[model samples]
Target: MAGLITCLSVPFLSYLGLRSLPAQETAPRTIVNLEVIVVDTESKALEALERLKKGEKFSTVAAQMSIDPNAGNGGYVGEAEVASLRPELRAAVESLQP
Candidate 1:
């Protein structure tokens, strides 16, 4: 009876030890600051991209052309966790370097 009890207790103690161990490491969360220029059509979006590439100021173009309510603030979307963003936006933001 004592031998059987010792065997059972050994496995139970080992199980408890494993459960108390810390979890595996996880990657750090990413945070990003974002701005956007929303437009009514693909053509308009393309034009805005062109203007930005050609040196037009972001604030100037956003205020003049974006349809989003935040246009007044130069399309600033504020800081956010990258994981919380939509999938398409997350992929785009992740591709950028800090």
Candidate 2:
């Protein structure tokens, strides 16, 4: 009986050592919708860059022509920065194209 308990206890102790919780990797993820529109031309893009250099905010211009339904009201890009913004949206904002 003692030997039986010892054998059973060994398995229980082994289980205690072997059992483990899964390791989770938490990564930063920002979700964004993929819809975007391209501005007309390089000249338009350059003009917007000039405006930015002149101390203008890109969002203000984007609000007028973003092609998103909210553009007229406000570009309202939410939390995105230029570098992280949707490619076309960034281009359109910078270009301020009609």
Q: Number of the top candidate by lDDT?
A: 1
At residue 77, give the lDDT of candidate 1: 77
Model 2 lDDT on a 0 to 1 scale:
0.53
Who wins the TM-score comparison? 1
Per-residue lDDT, model 1, residue 43, is 95
lDDT of 1 by residue, 1-98 (tens): 35542211212247447433333444578888888899999999999999999999998889989999989999897999999999999999988877
Backbone clashes, candidate 2: 0
Candidate 1 backbone collisions, by pair: none
Where is model 1 poorest over a 10-residue stretch in terms of lDDT? 4-13
lDDT of 2 by residue, 27-93 (tens): 4554443332225677766665676689877666555435566565445535554557668766765
Query: What is the lDDT for 6 in model 1?
Result: 23
